[model samples]
Target: MSQQSSKPEAPKSGGWIKPAVEYGPIVLFFISYKIWGLMPATAVLVAASVAATIVGYLRAGRLPWAPIITTAIVVVFGLLTLIFHDDTFIKMKPTVVYTLFAATLWGGLLLKKPLMERLMGTSLKMDHAGWRKLEARFALFCAGMAVLNEVVWRTQTENFWVNFKFGSIFLTFLFMATQLPMIKRHMLPDPAESESKGAAGE
Candidate 1:
């Protein structure tokens, strides 16, 4: 009889669509802001974020809750920016969103939830210690982003902050790329390999 593998199958990568899923909304918002200023750009951002979420769900067969949560914040802040006629609310979106993410990650660690594993366990096969390490580091990264966003929007000119926001997508992706080594170092043993070693009595 055939047997199922011990782990869930990793989900499909969603191919080239993944970049558009992640960055298209932000790029559109940047362009809109360049042409139309904050109010119209806020509207564009809110719509683009919603569209991205829908496209992501269609591609992956599941909603990406991480971005959904971020988009929700954008919706609220964007609405405020429109209603109140102040860009400050939208400007604060990144800080609040990143702070919430950091808090959730650290809180999950405190409660022993392994939240990162729950979200990525299928795609990432790693030991418990590895999961915990990745979780803590990601939490720290979020916290750092929150502080950085706050500093930029508060101290910098609007043009400077907008440029920084656009630039940050690449920085964030680069940071993720740098984590590949750590992920490789901490990979779990393949079940087939483990079984082979067992059969060999090694």
Candidate 2:
């Protein structure tokens, strides 16, 4: 075979690409709203979502499911907000998104497919028990987030809600940090090392 044929395949988009696209729109939305207002911010968010999707596809050679879903939601709700000139549609976006996540997670568990395991199993090496427990925790956390958004949007000022939208990213990181210990404890054992230890014992 030619050396060219033996060359490694190019890697797809990962790491910073995912989070930056996911959260960058929210940050821009907050800034836009602070400077202009909700309608304009919503427009900026919708545009950003579309741009992020295109960027992801251009870099990765295929569209990612998360960004596609996010773009769809943003475009739909953003249009609704602009059409009606009401903030209600945009404000309920987080609640709807989180509720969908919670529902998807629970449905996956019901179908005997752990949600997190299916989504992150490639990157996260954890035993079945860990995956199951992590899935449950994530589902619960999503539900909590939905409820929290409902409360905040229904009770707080528009400015506060915008701030909370940005703050939610921080909350997500905090939640993951809390799971580090559990994840480490439940990581899959090293098979080769285990076998070596068993051979030594024998």
RMSD of each: 3.5, 3.6
> How badly does each model clash, as a count of residue pairs?
0, 0
18-135 per-residue lDDT for model 1 (tens digits): 5666678789989998999878888999999888888777766676568788878889999999999999999999999889999999998999887999988877899888888888
Give the number of colliding residue pairs in candidate 2.
Answer: 0
Most accurate candidate by TM-score: 2
Q: For residues 1-202, could you state the per-residue lDDT of candidate 2 as single tens digits?
A: 6766534333224665687678989999989998998899999999998888788777767755656777888888888999999899999988888888889888888888997797677667899889988888988998999999999999999999999999999999999999999999999878879999999999
Q: Which pairs of residues clash in candidate 2, taking residues 3 or more apart in a chain or in different chains?
A: none
Candidate 2 C-alpha error for residue 75, in Å: 0.9
Q: Against the true structure, candidate 2 has what lDDT? A: 0.85
Flag regions of model 2 displaced more than 4 Å. 1-12, 190-202
Q: Candidate 1 — number of clashing residue pairs?
A: 0
TM-score of each: 0.86, 0.87
